[model samples]
Target: MAIESVVVRQRVEDLDAAVPFYERLTGSTASRFAFAGVTLASVGPFLLFSGPDEAVRRVAGVAATLAVGDLDAAVEDAVAGGAEVVAPSAPTPNGHRAVLRHPHGGVYEYVGP
Candidate 1:
């Protein structure tokens, strides 16, 4: 597997407000998606969030995103390793991705380019 390392992710309290700020910062529009009552914005490989306090508390920071060539395979591996598919694989405005919660509570996004 070619693990290209973590790309980008940011934890925020309000996704509604955060997206606009990030859009301006990146000088690009956000590709938005809803997961776990939180909104996610993708600007290139950066996965930024604005959502529930609980979700933010759990992640507590920028959750690492692994850029995998095949998102399905990475998700399968995560599941086999006792990770739960917090967000199933799907096509977003940015690309394709799936969110997993590791057995130890760390959240990760396996993303495809």
Candidate 2:
């Protein structure tokens, strides 16, 4: 599958406080959404998420979100490449997402339309 875009996710303690900074940094207003308990905003290629410690912790320090052409194929390819599945493919506001630990031990989320 071809990678479409790379989204940088930043886990923050306060969505209100974080949005302005990213908006200025990206020079664009953010599109907001809520998933599970997390408040998310998309500004340019950045995705800012804020929520409870537990929910945010799960994605903290993740390398990046790899937007791809095929979510299923990407997951399969990741597994075949010695990556470990952290979260199976599931629906999200944008599309679908699956977390994986690359063979070299980097954690990332794969997203697709």
Candidate 3:
């Protein structure tokens, strides 16, 4: 079966602080979505957050993982966007992956096939 899409949700303490960094990493501006006092940023295949909610915080960890067409480019872009590489890009048990930390303590994983 074909996987249509994937989305990972993260809870944030402040939405505004998270947007620009994500926008830079994804190389696309976030499409904002709000409901029930929750704000979300749709960055390509992942959905990220910024707003207060205890339950969301408890459930959120390693917020999203992006499957990219080019690992090298993604890594370079992430670095240029001010993301700190938590894990350098390398082949994993599953595939190639690299971890990056956003300015606001959110984590993202970039994987390539």
Candidate 4:
């Protein structure tokens, strides 16, 4: 599958307070959305997330959201490449997503249309 954008994830205590910095840094206004219980904002390729500690902790320090052409195919590729699936693929505001932990222990959220 062809990889699209890689979105960096940032977990913050307050979405409102955290957005301005990203906006300034990327020189782009953030587009807002809510997924599950978390509030999200996209500024350039950065995805800022804020929500309850329990939910945030699940994705804390996640390297990046890999955008792909097909979610199922990406999940299959990840498993074949020795990545452990943390969460099965599911629908998201943008499209679909799944979480995986690489063999080296790097966790990432993969998103696809």
Candidate 5:
């Protein structure tokens, strides 16, 4: 599996309020999107999110967002290594994503074309 990039996950009360700070800090413009009732912004190496409590709770525990080379292969390898599937591979506004918990208990969100 090829790990292309890693994005730190951050939750906020409002995406509009949070994106500008990250943009200024990272010196990069934020790319915005919406998924499953939550708003998301990708700024440099940070992925900022905001939504209702229940919506946020649904995605809790994901340590970070990983950009991978191949979603299918990544999922296969993760499962082989004892990573339990939290959410199956599915399409996202940005691309494809899958959630899994590593053997050591860290949950991760993997994204790929």
Candidate 6:
């Protein structure tokens, strides 16, 4: 599967406070959305989130969010490359998602249309 993007994930206390600066820094307008009660904004290569601490912490371990051309193929490739599926594929507000952890202990969230 082709990797469409590697978006850095950041947790903010307030989306409104965080989005404007990220927009200026990334030079892209925010595309706001919500997932599992958390507020999210995609600005350039960054994905900013704000929500309850418990909800946000569940996804905080992910080093980055990968946008893939094909989620199933990406998951297969990752597993073949010594990665473990920490969270099985599931539908999110934006698309399907799966979380995986590599042998070296890096965690990533993969998302696709």
Per-candidate clashes, comma-separated: 1, 0, 0, 0, 0, 0
Model 3 per-residue lDDT tens digits across residues 91-110? 75446877789777888777
What is the Cα-based TM-score of model 6? 0.91
TM-score of 5: 0.93
Across 1-113, the per-residue lDDT of candidate 6 in tens digits comes to: 67888999999888999899999998999999988778899999989998898889876878999999999999999999899999999998788999999889999999996
- Rank candidates, TM-score, best first: 5, 6, 2, 4, 1, 3
| Local distance difference test, candidate 1 | 0.74
Question: In candidate 6, which residue pairs clash?
Answer: none
Model 2: weakest 10-residue lDDT segment is 53-62
Q: Per-residue lDDT for 11-65 in model 4, tens only?
A: 8788899999999999999999987677889999888999888777666657898
Better of 2 and 3 by lDDT: 2
Error of 3 at 110 (Å): 0.7
Candidates in order, TM-scores: namely 0.56, 0.88, 0.47, 0.85, 0.93, 0.91
lDDT of 5 by residue, 15-104 (tens): 888888999999999999877788888999998888898888766568999999999999999999899999999998889999999999
- By lDDT rank, best first, the candidates go 6, 5, 2, 4, 1, 3
Tell me which of candidates 1 and 4 scores higher on lDDT: 4
lDDT of 1 by residue, 5-62 (tens): 6768777667777778777887888787766556777766567777668865544443
Clash pairs, model 2 backbone: none
What lDDT score is found at residue 64 in candidate 5? 91
Candidate 3: residue 77 lDDT (0-100):
79
Summing lDDT over every window of 10 consecutive residues in candidate 6, give the lowest-scoring window: 53-62
For residue 104, what is the lDDT in candidate 4? 95
- The regions of model 3 sitting more than 4 angstroms off are 1-60
What are the root-mean-square deviations of the candidates from the true structure over C-alphas?
Answer: 4.3, 1.5, 11.4, 1.7, 1.1, 1.3
